[model samples]
Target: MLKRTRKHIKQLKRSITQSLNTPGRPTLPQDELNIIERIRKAAAANNQNNITRTQAYFNFYQNHPEVHWALLAHLVSRNAGWNMTDLKGEYLPKLLTDQEQVDFFAFLERGNWLIFQDAYPQLLLYEESKKQKRPLFHLLDPLNISKFMKPFWENMWSNERKEELTIALIINEQQYIEKRVIHNTHYKNKVLDTIMFKLQDVLDFNHILIPYTTPLQQKTKLVGGTVHHFSSVEDRITLGKGLYDLLFSVQSRLTQTVKWAETNPHTGSRKDYWPDLFNDVKESTPGQVHELKSSPCSLQVKASRIYSPSLPSVWKDWEHNKAEPGDWYPNKKMFHFVKQPIKQLSGDIEKTYCETIEELEMAAFTKNTFFHKK
Candidate 1:
């Protein structure tokens, strides 16, 4: 009887342990786990409030498991250069403060998991396709141009002012504006939830307000004057020059902004000689980007159809969109609602754009066709 009782107890224990083990928690690899632990430590050292950084990791790992170690390794690599001892005067107003930047570095490092979805180990790898493709400029009507260019611009700048200037100009030229139209949140905002006071300011600037809006009824209010969609194939000379002027300025100014990184010829690693992520007005004067690249007014919008098929009736709003607060800005996303391969136009300088709409169209597609926070 005693032997039989011991056997029963052992079997019962085995069954319980097996139930508990059921591939619990979908753990990352040991190396990946170690990286996450190090990131947590790094985040804490930068700030006691490493909550945001932690959550970003949690979210990434929850979904993508394949590159977890690669991502973690990628993140730890960024800690290689940051000089954290300096504070306000040391690193401020240029690259975030030592603490803020360190914290961000950690966060982004952990974000490697998401980034690893593409090029994992190299920064130079981005936009290789864009570099290979020699692109042409366009002055297609402002709204269409704005719609296409907005995401590209947003991807390249971090400052709200710079982004705003770019967006306003794009919209002004495109002659249309899109409000978030629906409420949504940025990643940081969602993690902080209601505790974030900045949420108010972000919402004011980022969210579109429409009290009557519902998922059932997608609605938006266009804040600015809407440019009529161009139907005329007649050369839109005024527009072509305007677009070229703005784009050329952006490219020139931006190039000047990032020039230091390219020319300084630093030794060591990226983090080691990271010449202040960008320069300031005081440290070095910004080169002028306002120069007209060509005979400004001579530029014309070359269209396939010289005579517009007659633009449809004008409306105050461009289109209704369903957007959320979680979406990131300084990033543009387009959803296709119209099925037609709609054609539009823009041009400038001596190039006269491409000879046919096919070339022009191809040029526009090729230009700056990459995205990320530059």
Candidate 2:
């Protein structure tokens, strides 16, 4: 028997009944436990949009007594060839209906569904069990089995169809068992947040096009279970390009005018970013040093500096200037042309991330996952 905190159990009971209408207050079934696990994975993978729909899919499985789905849940646990941890594999099935049996055998031939979306073909999206279990839901009469078959599904089962069926079976079983499942404190992090963080760990956000709280259709290159991680140079170039495009677009907005220094001068006053200046100046007063007012300010200093198409934009890869060879010269000065115009740019580019876009996620719980409660 699993234990829950008093407060959690109360909410748990309510969520169970409201969602599934389970008779009498009872503990979760094994399928419900597994559903919790699946939810954890889906959340971890940054697939929150599928969360609600999937829960609904599972509830339908449990409620529709006509569809026996107990065996389906069991199939999801098998290791077989596909990696279950990564959610990639062929799902297991049991042919209770005559049509299902026929369709199942047809898969032995070279028949499969044709997918059109631009996505990783070899990369398995989700994994399911290979060995099937017995059905929990059965019809009142034996003859009703023939009527349940869909014409399309009845034609012939392809490898893709088999995989789809496995997915369906997992969802169906959840329908009945979901309400019984308890999320508990196991929900250590927001699913969407976790997904985003993981993606960041692998690649930059600009590289991935996952919209918040939505089904993801990413075009990726996965070698084995891992994505083909781009080189650091590639990531920098991509990020720089995205920023350049955005900055340029905003510059063209023209609601506010923007102008740049006439030369390749470092003028933008970086707020709180000044280095420790080596002051070799002889001061008249120890504490009261005069603010060396040199020409007051530069006229070109503006609110924002935007990269325009006509502007000579150089990649300016960070390379230090070569050391100068010196002859016997008297008091030769080295001048640095830094455009220091205070109040030149907005007070730091305030970055904002929508809290509503965040989601709950799950993982095995690493040491870095925990933090002191603020």
In candidate 2, what residue range of length 10 has the lowest lDDT sum?
110-119
Relative to the true structure, how large is the alpha-carbon lDDT of every model? Answer: 0.25, 0.20
User: Would you estimate the TM-scores of all the predictions?
Assistant: 0.20, 0.16
120-225: candidate 2 lDDT, tens digit per residue:
0101112122122322121101111111122112211222233222222222222212111111121113221244334423332112111111114321111001
Q: Can you give the lDDT of residue 64 in candidate 2?
A: 36
lDDT per residue (tens digit) for residues 1-374 in model 1: 01224543344335434433435234456744554444334433332212222233323423443222222222222221121111111112132323444443333233322222111211111122134342111111110132233322233222222322222232222222122211123324332232221322232211111011112333211111111222111112223223323323444332332232233222212212222221112232222111122232232432112111100111111221222122122232221101112222222211221122223223223332332112
What's the residue-level lDDT of 60 in candidate 1?
41
Show where candidate 2 strays beyond 4 Å: 1-164, 173-374
